[model samples]
Target chain A: MSYFSDIYKGIKTLLTGMSVTGKYFLTSRKGAITQQYPDNRATLKMFDRFRGEVIMPHNENNEHRCTGCQKCEIICPNGTIEIIWDRGIDEETGKKKKKIDQFVYHLSMCTMCALCIDVCPTDAIIWGQNFENSVYDRTKLTRVLNEPESKLMPGVED
Target chain B: MALREKNNKPNSLKTNNLELGTQNMKPETINSNFKSEEYQINMGPQHPATHGVLNLLLTIDGETIKKVEPDLGYIHRSIEKMCERDSYQQIVHLTDRMDYLSSNINNEAVCLAVENALELEIPERVKVIRTIIGELTRISSHCLWWGVMGMDVGALSTFFYGFRDREMLNDIFEETCGARLTMNYNVPGGLMLDIHPNFVKRVKKFVTHFKTKIPEYDRLLTENVIFQKRTKGVGVLSKEDAISFGVSGPVARASGYSCDVRKYHPYSALDKVTFNESLKTEGDTFARYQVRIQELWESLSIVEQLIDNIPEGEYRVKTNAVIKLPKGEFFQKVETARGEFCVYIISTGTKSPYRLKFRSPGFSNLSVLNHIAVGGKIGDLVAILATLDLVIPDIDR
Candidate 1:
């Protein structure tokens, strides 16, 4: 008698389990949580704080805020950022000043910890929202952040 | 046959056989020729049930497992060794890879250790936010575990349901911390930045949504007769054995052992909020499963209590760009989703620690597997392993 009752209880619980999934099946179209990726490419938007990749934003005059300060390079945990600087004569002061030659960013080695962005004194580097970083070649991942011929923004040193 | 004759057990069997009119038969015939040999099989390094790259060399005699020997180091990144080379702030990010599920809690552990060593006074706001986020991390980890545990036991639908809720939590983490899994939000002094504008609103929404869905979780899996039968009596770990094995987290708590790091050594506003240590005395797979389930609710309550009343203040206290710890040993332990995750740092008044060690919960929990899995079947081993809820990188690191 107890054995028969056990089977009954088992079936009842199994049905209860099925009912949870069954409700979802009935509301499948309205309740679907999966986003149609690539199809919804235009609609897909990352959050404002999303740390996709590091990019140095240049203004209309092809001028960036970086003052050749190596704070980012020093603060970066993975050595992801490398800044090459040279002493150049300032146009106004006529005195030697540190100017950036290159700002090399290795996207492959970056963990996206955002320490570089946090430590950037001039807000030169910010997180870019473009997350599609896949490249066939490994060397393609090593990118130069500043645009070619882009000079440092005037008065950023202050 | 000659070897059997040399044994005293065979002599007794031969005398008994002679009385039974089988004296004409050889003495060796007294014993049955049927023999069973214990064979070895590797469960993983690639197997789905092992969760990560954990290899278990299972010795079995037919259907029953004789021994389970876990082979680790496959996914080892030598995170402890890496910590020595990294600065104190940089070390937080490496811990994210150790227990990816509880990345926030792992980061908090290291930060707390550094802060303690420096003797920095953490503001009330930072403590509250850290506690809220840490509890949310716990819930999200448990949600994933619940789904995976169900899938391991042949319930496929739970996976989708679990991920659906987990996606919301991941979005919240991404909004505030900029990364979903490896959220290195906790700096040594405080948080990296202020919470996002939508952080409180979104977390409140998730709390209400999760409150309703937890009941569905019970109906779908917990109360299911098949699940109960598979787990109830399987892989029973007694209270004494749980302590002896040094298993912390739900695995130890299931055995009626009171070892909640949060309850005992409250850190980061944990003392401000009240929560019961979810415990069960059965010490079986079902008990471990139930303890984690109860904890999910406890974590929700904790978040609800603190989410609305997050005191407004500066998110981060400005620390020196180059932080050097005073020469001494510092330790901080936080209860992660798995168990007590401890960070021990020995600093020689340098930017980086001289030696750093992580006492991860998964390592101790895994050692108890061979003790419990001996009499169970191969399928039972999978169920037992699933209940352990091991994140292999934590063990390997």
Candidate 2:
């Protein structure tokens, strides 16, 4: 009698397990959780706060907000950001000011920790929403964030 | 020749003659001819059952495992050594790699240690938010463990169901922290940013969705006959042995050791929330599984209590650009999804710590494997390992 009872209990539990899977199987079409990533590229959107890569934004005048403070470079744990700057005369004030020659950003070495973004005093650098950062060449990952011939925005230093 | 001699004797005296002959026989002859030999096998540096790059050397006699020696350092990233060069703010990100499933909790532990050394008082809003996020991290980590536990016992469907629930939590994390896996949200003074505007709304939605799915989980794996049979009495650890081995989290709770760091220490807003420790006296594999499942419910309740009541205030307190701790030692411990995770820092009044040490939970839990797994079969060893829910990087770190 105990042997028969054990078999009955085993079957009953297995059928209960089967019912859970069976319900999912019948409704899987509407309840599917998987996303077709590449195919849905047009409709796909990342969160506004996603930390994909660091980028320097420029207005239509090709002017930026960077005042060459180098705070981000100094605070970066991995030396991912490098700024090359030289003294130049400010056209408006006729005073020599430190301006960036190139804001070198190594995307390859970036951990996406956003430490630099947090430490940036000028708000020159920001998180981009683009997450598709893969490339065939490693050197391509080392990017110059500022556009060519870009200069500091007017009154940004003030 | 010994068998032939026994056959010639009378049936009543045969047993006596055989015993006498064997007692007189040389020990080396018996060892060379009839003794069973123990063999060794490797479970993995790449084995999926290990859940990460953990190499286990197992000694077995026939089907029973004689020993399980965990060979670590395969994925050792030298995170403690790296902490020596990084600033207090920079160190929080590196802890994320240690236990990636509970990265937010790992980040919070380092931040709390730094804050304690600074003697800074955190805002009420920060405390409540950190507690809510930590509990969510616990639930997500347990979700992954549940899936892997079922898969380890040959139930494949649990993996998909577990990941489906975890994906929702990841989305909530990404929207708020900006990264899904390694969320460097906690800083020394407070959080990196305020919780996203939709954070409360989305979390409320997740709590409702997850409440219904937990019952489905019980049916899918918990009540399954095969899962129960594989886990019930596979590995048993007594309360005394659990304390002696220094095991914590669900592993120690299953043994009725009362070692929940959250209950005893009550860091962050845990003192405000009332929840059970989820204990079981059985200490077997099934008990461990049940404890983690019960914890999932407790975590959900914790989120519900704190979600609508998040006080509005400044998210972070301003700290020095170059943070140099006064010359002293500081220690802080937080209950990660695994167990008690401690951060010890010895600062010589510099921007970086002179020495840093992490007391991870997985390493201590892994030490008890050989003690419990000796007499169990190889399959039972896998089941025991699964219920332990070891994150290999957490151990190696």
* Winning model by lDDT: 1
DockQ of 1: 0.70
- Backbone clash pairs for candidate 2 read none
lDDT for each residue of candidate 1 in B105-190, tens digit (9 for 90 to 100)? 99999999999998999999999999999999999999999999999999999999999999999999999999999989999999
DockQ of each candidate relative to the true complex: 0.70, 0.64
Whole-model lDDT per candidate: 0.93, 0.92
Question: What is candidate 1's lDDT per residue for A1-158, written digit by digit as tens?
Answer: 97998899899999999998999999999857798998999999999999999999999999999998899898788899999899999999999999999999999999999999988889999999999998899999999999999998998962
Q: Where does model 2 exceed 4 Å of error?
A: B1-35
Largest TM-score belongs to which candidate? 1
Model 1: clashing residue pairs? none
- Compute the lDDT for candidate 2: 0.92
TM-score of chain A of 1: 0.96
